[model samples]
Target chain A: MPSLDKTVAEPMIVFDGVEKRFGDNVVLSELSFTVAPGEHVCLIGPSGSGKTTILRLLMTLEKCDGGTISVAGQSLSHMTHNGRRVPADEKHVRDVRKRIGMVFQQFNLFPNMTVRGNLIEAPTRVLGMSKDEANARATELLDLVGLGDRIDSHPTQLSGGQQQRVAIARALAMRPDVLLLDEVTSALDPELVAGVLKLLRDIGSSTDITFLCVTHEMGFARDFSDRVMMFDGGRVIEDAAPEKLFTAPEHERTQAFLHAVVDR
Target chain B: MDNLGTFLSVLSQGLPFTIIATVGGILLTIVLSFVAGLALLSSSKTVRVISRIYVEGLRGTSEVVQLFWIFFALPVLVGFQIVPIWAGILVLGLNHGAYGAEIVRGAVQSVPRAQVEGAIALNLTPGQRMRRVVLPQAVVEMMPPFNNLFIQLLKSTSLLSFVSINEITRQAQQVLVPRFNPQAFEIFLLLLVMYLILSLVITAIMRTLERVAAARVGRRPSARSRRQATGAGVA
Candidate 1:
């Protein structure tokens, strides 16, 4: 895990006073957070507490209703070149988005593709890598995720845990500067969750890609995260070292929520 | 004897048109349906709303009325006349396209949002995502429904008689109306057989396609122990 000094080396993502709403309901209100390069930041909260929304905003799946988001020292919510704001164009968005990869709660493996195909697709398409190069990288990723034998298999042929691992491999194949994981193990059967978590843990240890994870896997978060942000009502209620937040939380909501999750 | 000879000649002459219209209209319907269905999902508000209205309006009305409107009324409305056959085919295509649009949209949308988001996460552009991920799944799910619609469109082409296009039904009507021949029943029966055979052929093709597509997605066609096929061997 990265320490404060290592984090101070450079900020990879910056969210400044981000505000998002759905009609009258505000999902994210004046949210400010940052993830330094090589840091793993875990976001935890109740179901509707905007943990997923934060990741979505970074992915450009959802736009912020207010504030600016910068990734790799460039604006995410808009296009900027040399500190001048411009209308976000497709090319610009694609360029920015190319640097980020996300793994969804629902392992959205391409049903039409083999596991190998899923991993190679982005590399061949977005990264402009040769087919041979992409395939080789896909093999490496599948092997890394412990599914080398399943590379030729379609997603439906694999178990849920296997599919999620493939999804992570597919994300990693992009070699993204940052990775967003949204409830990566939420949809797995209870028995299968550990395998997927272990794969993510392996990824966290092996790569320097900054990870922003939204999850209820408190155990994994506490072990793998450099920092943990506890959110409620779309605002951060607690932000501190995972050990401090888990053992000696300062807020009632954080303490109660952690008890509800961890004590179970 | 003389009437019988003329009837055969007329029916023969008109047979091609009937086959052509139905075949052409059905093809057009498939294309239109896929396009309009995708149009409804456009990120632009104008495109989505326009496609929605077009689909709703077309699906709501009778096919015959739409045929007449496009073929007969459209010339006056647009101040330029189209050939009757062209109008009939076009109208059939539009009407079917509207219905098809819904099937396409529903099938595509039925593909879980998770899959789409997955594609997005992979840095796929919208077009690549649809072509590579979403459409393949949607097209698989849409096969049965689309096959049903195609068969319906085939039968619906009989309505072309109203616009003076000589299709199978029209030829039959023309043959029987003047002579009052008892063989009308027999001839109509033959037409029914032809339709039945056509529908059966269509069903077979669809089944084959379904098998091929499902196999692509790693589905065993049936649970009964049959020899498992290896890879898609040249559809």
Candidate 2:
């Protein structure tokens, strides 16, 4: 286990007064938060409350309308130019984004590639790892994801749960410091959901990689997260430890939201 | 009956030229289509504008008029003349290539946003993303449309005969014009059969390629069959 004292020395991600809007709709307003290294944080909310948008922002998939986002003490949304901060250029964003990996809700594995090909692609092309080294890393990651024997299979050949696991392995192959999970299990079969959740729990507990997840699985959130943030109307309405937040919530919206989720 | 022999002899004499023009035109079309399609996606406004102008200019005008412009007008402007066969190849290539660019652009654009996002999340450079991920999938979608375009290009080669290139159609006209019988129907029917055979050959080749591409992408056999059915019907 990573020591909490060491993990808190510096924050891994910081969103300062972030604002995002799509045309007429505001997705996130003045969203601010810090994720410590090795910390596992979960964002739970009703649909369209900007839970996935937070992860998308970190991955640089979506740009913020206003405010700065920093990863590992470096500005992701801005570049420092001669002592002044301006919007980040493509090169700057690419450099900062190299340290982050995202597993999407749809398990968007490359359909043209086999499982092993998907795993080795970025490592060889982007990271400039040797073919042999990438192959070895892919083998190890497949083993870690418990799909070692299935490395030759195409993503379409796998079940949804298996595909999600391959996606996890592919993300880990980049060796990112921060892993963003965006409703990773929401698309899975009900019976197949637990197996994937168990794999993620193992990954979270065993690695020092920081996790920022958006999920609807309340039970998994309660058991796995170091902190649970309840979002409503594009803002964090409740932020607390899972034990306290799940049992003794402070915000009315949080209670009502939990009630609706539980009833479902 | 003697006219039948003359028709066959004329068609056989013209067959090589027709085949050469079609093959050369198709090859040039493939190259131009990709160049124009990728230019349409370029970040530079100038490239995008230039590509759009080329695609629209060629696609909007009649191909036969364009061929005449190249064969007749271009030589006066440039102070040099191209051979009739080369002019046919150039005009056919550019016109079909312009139409083909749309197919390439549509296929590339149709790749799911999620897949592109996945590539971006891996920090693949824009070039690497397109080459390794985007194009491989786009090529699968492109094959059927490309087959259609190639057949259209092949048929368009018949227009080259108007420019005094001795292709099948030109030879058939020569056989009909001097003969007293003026057996135009028999000669034209033979020309039609020749075109039909060429189209069927192209369809067979493209279907084989589509199946190979589909296999590489691991497309399901059922989906492959459905696509093949539609693809054959379109061809």
Candidate 3:
């Protein structure tokens, strides 16, 4: 909630020609994008289109082989040292990463901790919040997520929808300025996806947190996102407001992609 | 009655030595297991190679041969000699410590990749992720294998008899009972019973440890254990 930087006009996230590869297979090639502060942006495309790789790079789970990524005006991949820009060190990456939080498709909750324990873990350990303060904040977040009554239960005890909800609460506990969501409901049962998406919709409407989401849920993209970018084979073919992009896409690839997706 | 008294008294003389070797080996094996286990997963290539050498070297050789070398040749090489009992303890620790290290390595790796990613996503430091996330789960996975190693180490204690250490097996071997003829079968039977009891005790202890560890990661206690815990409270 504190001022993220000296200038409020800067975009919350900027990817300038970022490239990533695994051996001979290229994942993202010269990927360029940006999200304005408090804007909710969604990337939609077929599987293996490099949408999720974009989220992973922003999360610092994978490094880009070329170009730079910046969050809240602080460069994630490189930093200026003594007036010369160089690759960021571990400490530099971690310092910049403190502002970002990610939720995976798998709902990767720590089995070793209960719902309350999961929520309090980062707030107390990384932020140095006292036990009492963390517990109180955890209670607040649980209430926000509509799981206040089940704080003492372990993750395995919860349904997939409930578990993903707790995963969302855990990410929010960090008070992250940028939240990267990677197909958060993809692993849920078909019956459970609607509940998780509705929760996300509520959070998106209520908060000013910058969101960069990679999801296959075209409905959520159309209803909730400020802008939707269509990706194909690691490149964005079209980037436009959700209404325009979904209803009247200009590119042939975008039109065909939507046709295939919507028909299914 | 008189012969029975003599048999019990002679065997009891070596009982303390047998217990000391087994217990000492267990403690030593535990420490080395963690050290080598963690070193196997260390980031530095040198650390991993050094741990591999210790693990593979001990596992590849025969236990008795290793024990004899440590007790006999090691002294000549190092220009000093340890008492045979201490040497027995050291050899047992090193031998089983190898298997224990592999068990540890497997458990640590078995922790899901997603669990680690969740920790990193939370921005917890590397040490925190291992301690608060990976190890608590891995320790539960280690209990069963460690139980097996502890029993094997207990049986290995009988090897100490070769170094002139007075223990159960040595006493049975040296016993003649010439006036009453050989009681070798009787002594051997008694030895089997005694070791069975020891193995069961070790198994029970490990079971309790496994249950406690599983509970830490949120396993529901079974009704049987819950009743036993309550009964223990009452008693």
Candidate 4:
């Protein structure tokens, strides 16, 4: 495992007073957090508590209704190109987004592409890596994910666990600084969950890249997370280190959620 | 003998018109379909409403009515005269586009939203998502409906003759009415054969495209191919 404790001078991501609402419903309210470089934070929440929204906003897939987001010392939701603090444009968003990668619950592999193609696509197209270089990286990632033998297989041909692993490899092929996992193993069959979790655990142990994972797996959170946040009603009700938050949560909602999730 | 020559010459003349209308209509339809389909999925409500109205107005009217509007009313309304053949081509293209629009919209929408989110997770922009992920899958699903629309467009080209566009049906009528030939049935049968052959060619081409798309997506081979590959499954 790499040393996550090797602290950097600047934080990697900052969400300052973020607010998001949908019509009459509030998905996130005044949510503020900062992830230092190499920190692994797990967002544990009940459904519709805006854990996934946090990831979406970071990816700029969803726009925040209020507040500023900064990634790598740059304002993401706003821009300051050439020393002028102006609203960010499409190009600026694209530039910021390139440094982040996300994994979905459904695996969401491109059905038109083979496993190797999925792994190589973004690195070649978005990152400007050559085909040969992308291919070599893809092969390396596939081996890491334990899908080296299934490199030529299509998404549908692989089991759910294998497909999610391919998706993880595809995300990693971009060499992102921030990786978001939105319940990556939730869609898999129970028998398939262990393999995916093991792969994630291995990556968590080995990489210094910041991780923001949304999950219900208490065991994985306890083992993998440096800090675990329990969210309820679009607010972080409990935020603490894994041992304190999981075993001695401060709020009733957190206690109820942990009881419900951990038992099964 | 003279009657036979007249039939052959007139039929040959009209054959070109039929080919032109059908092929030209298809090209126009694909363009319009893509435009209208994108409109339906537009983020703006006004754009969506406008697109819906255009599709409804065009698709609800009959082809004959559309032809009349384009050939007769369009000249009056706009104070410009278009050639009859051009009018036929324009009307057929615009009309077929409405139906093709529905196919494009349906196929694009049928793709699960999760697939789109996945693309977003990779930080792809809207344009990249459409080009790389959405459109490729939508195009494969779009083909089946497009095949039906194409056949309908082919048959509808016959209506062009009502506006003096000189398609095969009109030419055959011209020959039989003037010659008063006893072989009317035979001439019509030949016309039917020509249409059948054209439609069959189109169908064969569509099947080839479908096969290519399926193979690109890594769909399983047909039972025949499977059997051949496995040496008749050790029976």
Q: Which candidate should be chosen as best, given TM-score against the real structure?
A: 2
The candidates' DockQ values read 0.63, 0.84, 0.63, 0.49
lDDT, candidate 3, B97-186, per-residue tens: 887888789889989988998998899998999999999989877777787788888888998888899887787676634444566666
Question: Which portions of model 2 miss their true places by more than 4 Å?
Answer: A1-8, B1-3, B180-182, B220-235
Which has the greatest DockQ?
A: 2
Measured by TM-score, how close is model 3 to the native structure?
0.92
Any idea what lDDT model 1 has? 0.83
DockQ class, candidate 2: high
For candidate 1, lDDT tens digit of each residue in B1-235? 4455655566667778877887788889998998899999899999999999999898888778888788768888899989887887888789888888988998889988878788877778889989988888877777776677777777777899888888877877875655657677666666676667767777677668877887787774543212222111110
lDDT of 2 by residue, A1-264 (tens): 236564467799999999999999999999999988889999998999999999998988888999889888778877889889787898988888998999999999999999999999999998999999999999999998889999999988999999999999999999999999999999999999999999999999999999999999999999999999999889999999999999999999999999999999
TM-score of each: 0.87, 0.95, 0.92, 0.86
Per-residue accuracy of model 4 over A1-264 as CA lDDT, tens digit each: 113443356788898899999998999898888888778999998899999999989987789999888887677878876878889998888888887999989889999889988888788878889999999999999999988999898898998889999999999998888999999889989999988999998998899889999998888999999999889888888889999997888899988888887677
True contacts kept of each: 0.80, 0.86, 0.71, 0.59
Clashing pairs in 4: none
Least lDDT summed over 10 consecutive residues: which range in candidate 2 chain A? A1-10
TM-score of chain A of each: 0.94, 0.96, 0.96, 0.95
Off by over 4 Å in 1: A1-9, A81-84, B1-15, B49-62, B65-85, B219-235
Candidate 1 is scored at a TM of 0.87
Model 4 chain B: weakest 10-residue lDDT segment is: B226-235
lDDT of 3 by residue, A1-264 (tens): 236465477888999999999999998999888899889999999899999999888888887899889987889978889999888897888888898899899989988899999999999999999999999999998898889999999888999999999999999999898899999989999999998899889998898889989998999999989999999999999999999999899999999999998999
